[model samples]
Target: MVELRRDPVVERWITIPRERAASIEGLFPGKQEVSRGACPFCPTAMHEREIYSIKDDQGRWSVLVVPDLRPILEMEGTLERRAKGIYDGMSGVGAHEIVIETREHNQSWATMAADQLGLVLRAYRDRSSQLRGDKRFRAIFMAKNYGGMASRFSHPHSHVLALPIVPRTLVEEVQGSEDYFQYKERCVWCDVKEQELAKSERTVALTDRFLVHTPYASRYPFELNVMPFRHVADFASSTDEEIADLGGCLRTTFEIVKNRLHDPSYSMIIHSVPLRNASEHSYHWHIEIRPQLTSLAGFEWGTGFFTNPIPPEVAAQHLRG
Candidate 1:
């Protein structure tokens, strides 16, 4: 069983899953394990269940989507929103799925072919679209925790979390974008993309349809945002051609980061409009990649402001080289 609890002061929802602690303990068995023979993501190993899959020309599954063995949120329960005193809570009723990127244990997104990466992106779009029909879910968050201290599993994979409520960070972003639109009558991300393209110092990689650049005020050293050149609010609405183009740009950017940073640990988050508010013109969809090179300290935790040691310009230069 799981529940969504609200923070009284901040009004943020926190997922309180009963089995999370035990699940996390089971994720990492021991620190000394280095062999890939015991990996569960391998093609030979057993999986819980396949929710979605994509096969290659030879009829072998190249990409697979499976339900998490120890999912934080269960899909079988009702929300059952209730209040206790001043606090509000609800059942953690959502979907948690994993996208197994490859059948081979050694392959990674950075090194994978563009076509294969495109198939993975297609899986994400299909899964999100399918989950959007459920009115209970407010948002679907797709994220990848790769390498370094950020990743618990060594296998290359990503997670899709269909959340009952929009996350605090996403709420803040939508609010900020809406405010900017009301003031300027334009999308904030479009303006940012335009400015970054005009000033190519922060631009790391670009394709005909997409642009990959370090944001003007990046929160981390090598933080990169991948956005379509055209103004688009929903990632699931992307065309097949657009998805392939995006795959190329994303793969190129990842290759650059890996080559420059010696394959650092990083997290990639897909930011998009909520399911209910699908027609939001003020907001634009993008992927934020944050390299786990820096750690948060007291000042960062106390204050919401992040201190980045490497400037965006320097980081962009390193990637461009």
Candidate 2:
């Protein structure tokens, strides 16, 4: 049976249609293609002309930074601003770098050791801190698109972009979170976590410091977000201990996804306060992990809405098992 939903953000009524799931009893259970032929991300292949790689004291290829061959915004372009009638355009000025996690072709986050993931997380923190020093960089965001939908490469890596303007999604979240905080005199997200935990519904996996859950009204099947348990405003300011705890959470999240979801393609992002707007009280740092289980149809973009077939309550139950 179809169900009606009330969205807090859109402040409107929505419908969730019912559908049957495909049976995967003997589906394509393929293993990860690790250490295959011609993996440039391998440590031995770091000498590629375009790669910026560094070695650790122990002599491992610990870090890598590369220019995206096809970047959304170009770095060498002039900042020419123009307007055509009601439309406006500006110079495409931004920096996009690919941070390769490891030299091993197959060592993804879930398969990596806790210490290794911690190092990758630290590298992200360090890179973000370094980019914030430049005044030209107004906003910085990092994203990992798994597989083709999430990325164009099979290597385990993420993209970091320093943009001239805040992203549209981030802008909406900042405004919404801030306004809700002011009116409620508390963080609405924090309130949400407390209620979710108390009710114990729509929660898939959890740790001492972080949790993974399907929101009350999900737009996609098996879509989830993993957020910190404590309150923090900036990702760069996280304590060393907090980073370790977060490493554990990251490991578990990927493990559960890989084992249960059958290695589905997903995109993960670390959302934090923008550099110029660092001290905003309304914004709280969080990480969102969304799996690409379904394609977006015309109805979604045209109406700016979606109808998730699997309810959050059911999705959580599936993941928990």
Candidate 3:
């Protein structure tokens, strides 16, 4: 077996090419939105603020949760449907909550300690359970968009979306995972872990409880998968210990990357079981982290194939070193 640091097959592989990167427009130039970003998410003094906040014993605010100012899916109060020329679209009716992870404007996930990240993860699970029970809600997804282009706000935060429809990505994952589960009579993600380990080509980082690898066919560049080696299926179902450990893994990975690579911006999203009719063992929970260093253009969107510049193995070696 090749050493963990320098696996030949893994190195010099195409992670996403330069032209491919250039192909994705509006990817670079780094999110020209929200000039001079400030602390607009701070807790207010009115019930009309529609924001909830947690504070430390010193009365200093720790975290803030508020409805998104520019909501993609704000509550319409009721669902009324109409049609356009040849397409059908509903009113943007969903909950978009901005989770202000910390008060520090400059600090981000990479700089956050494991304990701090754990608290944020707990907030996600807590909100997921609360939102999933809503009759109008169908799914709750936790996502973070870093850098200027990815989000309007620059602080370390994530969004908990309570969507009425199961997202297309969730639908696809269900179909793909379920098919593999039935055929192999085992969790496909578990099998994936084994395969990635055996291949050892994309492994980024491993800890006592977690393993981070680049997907064999990564949809995006610098895509890192953080999975619980024990095959936990739901992010909401994780224990406190697991959350803490996962947070540790997150912190370590980000710290290493920040130290090794100059890249500071990225996006992270969790792939967990759906809110309704979920087969616990049929799926596995994981997080995908992709740095905001590439763009997606027509060829990628048209052809449905993403080109990454830096190979996973090389990225991993650099990260591990």
Candidate 4:
């Protein structure tokens, strides 16, 4: 069984699943192809085990969710917390599923239609909400890696991981937001959004319900964040209309980035309040897009500070143009 081990100093939980190492070699053997090659995600090559799927009016799947063939954390296991000589650990009992964005292998997030992307987002929300019912899971993370360097597979897909313990980064984010609220009595993200809108400097695009902007303190060049105009802590609680607006906002944001950067590789991550937490008014959910342009050096690894060459203001101006 997979185990979640904690770093005593950092207070971070790490999943140690030795079983996945054997399947890693066979996961992505070569270039994935829709018609000519052996790509498991392709409709023709897809496995029969589908967890859930969203179908079009024509009765064809637009978005689908399936169990990961080689999951980092297994779904069926008891989350038994134990200690070993002052070290705390628990069984890695969580859900790992893949969100197949499209039936066509060539269809990508940047190129897909806004409506199609909305369906994909809906699938994410549905899966996350469903998985939250399991009392064993504490947090769910949704992430998509969109390049050869960042992704293990070439298929247009995202991963949803239901973790037994909240990640340290997310824990810090929640704490920081909570602390800020205690002092200011306002949501920090809401204030940031209002300030960005008022300045009209770092703002990329804005929909009726969403705002896309390059954060003032972006760690990477062209790092964009998509936030809701109205503060919402849980992404799964987003209404249909809000999700549709978000789809349009994301589509426009990606279009501008891809056109300017020549299809740069990036990673998109959804940040939401933990499932175990009460409805938090201080925390606002957002999607962060970090383009992988430069390599991380030793200095960056040693120090948590990132040395960005391009400023967010300049990046925003370029994206707007």
Candidate 5:
């Protein structure tokens, strides 16, 4: 049966196609061969200066944070808002940093040690907290693009962007959340966690502090959402214990995907509160993992809707097994 699902926190619809024709190999292509070239992310071949790093027992860097080699936005400029004929724009003033996830170039979240992943997650928290100090930045985005086609480089790294304005998608999400809170008087994500837990149909796994589940309106096959049980608005404020548990939770989730889908290319995004403002009561921080199983056809772009061959319930069942 074909189904159309609307996202709870966003006014977006996802259509589940009638035919489940995408096979495992079709969804996850074969692993690409790596080049034996000079990787700048490697410690010995590094060209950029480090902003922050965590050391291992041997005094070697475990996780490193460096400025993006080619930044999308400039870091030194102040926000300059401008208006043209019936249009508005701003200067490209923002901070873009690379969180070099692991010292080892070949390691990934699925393969890396749990403690090492914790260090990586901690680096994200530290960098976000540091960037929040800059009054010029209104929002911070944290994400990881993994596998050959998804990432620019083969190195295990993620990105952090501190923007002068909140992104449109995030703005909509916060607004939707606030509207829900105004009516229901509770956080939407908290309610989702509770409902998903109660149903267990879309839940893949659960830790003491986090829930790993496929959203009811998942846009892609094997899409995953990892949310903390605690209603925290900013990921930067995550406690040590919470981060540690989250590390294990993420590691297990990615490993499951890796094993089930043959290490597909995927993008992972962390959604949190804007830097300048607060949404503690209405919003909650969460992580979204979208495996690049299928490309967006013209229909999706033209209609602003996504088509998924696998229903989230079926995807969750496959993932759980």
Candidate 6:
């Protein structure tokens, strides 16, 4: 049997292909281990392009933020908007960097110490806050791709992008939240958090400062949303104590997913208010972790619809270790 679920906040529809639920394990394409020569992120191969870092007691860097080895945008240019006969283009002028989460070559979020993870979060906030000074940038996006096709290397690192223009998907989300606020005079995310916390059906784990849960209309199996109770629009504003709590919350979420799903590849994205719109109250910041258990076929790409083999409630139950 198949069922359609609609996300109340974004109004996005998800199809639950329950008939394939029994064969959910078959959908996960095992991540192939790649044999690589030298890891550039290691201390020996590291360069001096350090943007930000946190050091240990011995003066060694624990978390390092450096420019991306293969950056999509260059920071050495002025914002130049160009137009052709019918299309518009702009100079690829922005900042792209990599946040090395740890000094250990094989450390992962599931096994990393919570305090170490907190340092990683601090690096993210520090770099993002510094990049926000550039008025030319409209959005600062931070994301992590673990294993599978989503990542090129096996090392645990995340990307930071300072984009000149806001991505369309984020723009839509902000607009949707704003629309909901205009209608109900409340933040959509806050309402969702309240409802999920009250129900506890889809809630996997909750910390004092953060809530980790499965979305009612989850886009993928084992997908989880991590939200802070504080209605802050900017991730950069997260305090030290909040970051410490969130580190534990994230570690628990990823460890559960890793142990239950056999360590499937995943993508995690931080969706915060745009750089200029840091004070927007309508949009609440959150992080989305989507494990790549299934591939997207023609139906998904053509119709903008996602099919989940397992229900979010069941997934939450399995994940609530």
Q: Give the poorly placed runs of model 3, Cα more than 4 Å off.
A: 1-32, 42-51, 80-87
lDDT tens readout by residue for model 2, 208-313: 8777898887788988877777777667777778788888888887888888888888988888877778446767788788888888989997987999999989
Candidates' C-alpha lDDT: 0.88, 0.73, 0.72, 0.87, 0.85, 0.84
Give Cα distance to truth, residue 285, candidate 6, Å: 0.2
Worst 10 residues of 5 by lDDT: 13-22
State in Å the error of residue 11, model 4: 1.6
- What local lDDT does model 1 show for residue 206? 87
Candidate 6 residue-wise lDDT, 1-321, digit = tens: 333343444534343443445355545656344537998788877568888889999998898889986576767778776556544556767888999898788989999999899888988889889999998898888899998567878778999988887776888989999999999999999999999999999999899999999999998898899999999888988998999999998988889988999999999999989977733879999999989888888899998798889999999999875
Error of 2 at 61 (Å): 1.9
Roughly what TM-score does model 6 have, to 2 decimal places?
0.88
TM-score, prediction 5? 0.88
Q: Write the per-residue lDDT of candidate 4 for residues 28-95, one digit (tens) a residue.
A: 74744223457778787756788999998999888889999878899997889989988999988999
Write down the worst ten-residue block by lDDT for model 3. Answer: 1-10
**How high a TM-score does candidate 4 get?**
0.93
In candidate 6, residue 242 scores what lDDT? 94
Minimum summed lDDT over a 10-residue window in model 1 is located at: 26-35
The 10-residue segment with the lowest total lDDT in model 6: 11-20
Model 1 per-residue lDDT tens digits across residues 1-321: 888899989959987765535445545746533434578788888876889999988987889999987687888977789799999999999999999998877877789999889999999999999999998999998999988477667777999889999889998999999999999999999999999889899999989999899999998999999999778888888899999998888889888988999899999999989888733889999999998888888899999889999999999998999
Give the winner by TM-score: 4 or 5: 4
| Clashing residue pairs found in predicted model 4 | none
lDDT for 309 (candidate 1): 91
Pairs clashing within candidate 2: 145-150
Give the candidate order by descending TM-score: 1, 4, 6, 5, 3, 2
The estimated TM-scores of all candidates read 0.94, 0.82, 0.82, 0.93, 0.88, 0.88
Query: Evaluated with TM-score, which candidate comes out highest?
Result: 1
Error of 6 at 114 (Å): 0.3
After superposition, candidate 4 runs with Cα above 4 Å error: 19-36
